[model samples]
Target: MSPSETPEVVLHDLRAGDGLPLVLVHGFPLDHRMWDEVARFLPDGLAVVAPDAPGFGDALLTESEPSIEGIADAVAEALAARGVERAVVAGMSMGGYVALALAERHPGLVAALGLVDTKSVADAPEARDNRLRIADEAERTGSVAPVRGMREALLGETSRATRPDLVAEVGAWIEEQRPEAVAWAQRAMASRPDRTAVLAAYGGPVSVVVGVEDELTPIEQAEHLVESSHDASEAALVLVPDAGHLAAVEEPEHVAGALARLHARVTR
Candidate 1:
């Protein structure tokens, strides 16, 4: 395929394959590369595409203000550009917020939702305040330290001591993020409207994947989502063993397996 015919190789783009289209949205601090291993392990005939949010990875960082909804719109545009009318959209953490936003705003483009290690609740006032404080610190001293602290927070307690290398890798990814991008995302997340209604309102299939050891978005959060969602009885909940926030990176095989099961349930 000619380069122009293919999706732009930026922070995020469409990976070429055949069967159903699966859009993977990476969590904060990491780019689409975070999904590389999980994408490789997906079922054959699945066209896996991981799009990077603007300002992260190779995405062309414009001067636009950042918001999860804004990012979702960008993804929708990218998919339209690629002739993809609908896709099974999967997102991790912040990506989940974007996926839900996309599904809500452009109902026709999202066939299903795969929410991984994420939540449906909006940030509490304290949480939003904390984020603002962190953003201020990041702005003052660069985003690397705050992001490193965030990296530590995302990992399971055991990972800090047992999987230092993984922690380092995640920290490095955060450190590599452009400061402006990080700041923009922080503000966007703070300003985001509550999306619990989206979960309750959407009628399409939804799957919630949580890391057993996740501290950022705990199992309780997943339970809350499953209970609150419109398709609670049918929505699937997966708890990946030994994985933390970044389940796809921490336990790629387990995440891939969950995706396969969700795919079967949603597409079959």
Candidate 2:
């Protein structure tokens, strides 16, 4: 009953009565705090574990060059140590990449899947180069200033206009991240391969949620995820209205409801 042997508290664990644990992975340059609000609205007795991927949060910052595979492995080991043999895995943005990798690497570890505001394709040539450039800057300056303006791209038009406080809040979250974490994430993301095949191969119940106004990974990206799934018709799709890439943070209640529904499908 005690996780005394678990390596360390990764980020947040609301381990209520559990059948299958719900593992939430956060996006890049940010930590597990991004999922806190949405985690609150999930159904009762649903165990939730939100872990900061490797270098991003309270995790042990390593000198290892980050890779999605490394992040995926870290998540699996952490969960296994906590007695979670399998889980309903969900992630947003960079976290989604990690989730897809997790399912790919761990095979039977994922019982269901949730992808939010993320794409299955690798970065285009230009995008990959830009990420490396930012990584270099972050590592050199030892700061997140290189990616400081990401709030504009991460939030949707409506949220950006109406929620200045939200904008600032997200920015603050970015600023708190360690520069090494930021650099590690950028390089890891830049090196990720196209994972649409991961979706195509996965047979578990799948749900894809996105902010309606998400410009970075727009609705088209969400649609691609659903369509790429093994059974497209069964995949649940939830688009958070008036939100953007960080939909779960911008509109936690709605995203939480979407996750709750996904959980029902898995648990039922």
TM-score of every model? 0.91, 0.94
The whole-model lDDT of each prediction reads 0.80, 0.86
lDDT of 2: 0.86
Tell how far residue 32 is off in model 2, in angstroms: 0.6
Q: Which stretches of candidate 1 lie over 4 Å from their true place?
A: 1-15
Model 1 — TM-score against the truth? 0.91
Task: Write candidate 2's Cα lDDT for 27-96 as tens digits.
Answer: 8778889988888888788888899876667886665656887788878988887788889999999989
| lDDT accuracy of residue 196 in candidate 1 | 82
Worst 10 residues of 2 by lDDT: 1-10
Q: Which ten residues in a row have the lowest lDDT in candidate 1?
A: 2-11
Best of the candidates, TM-score: 2
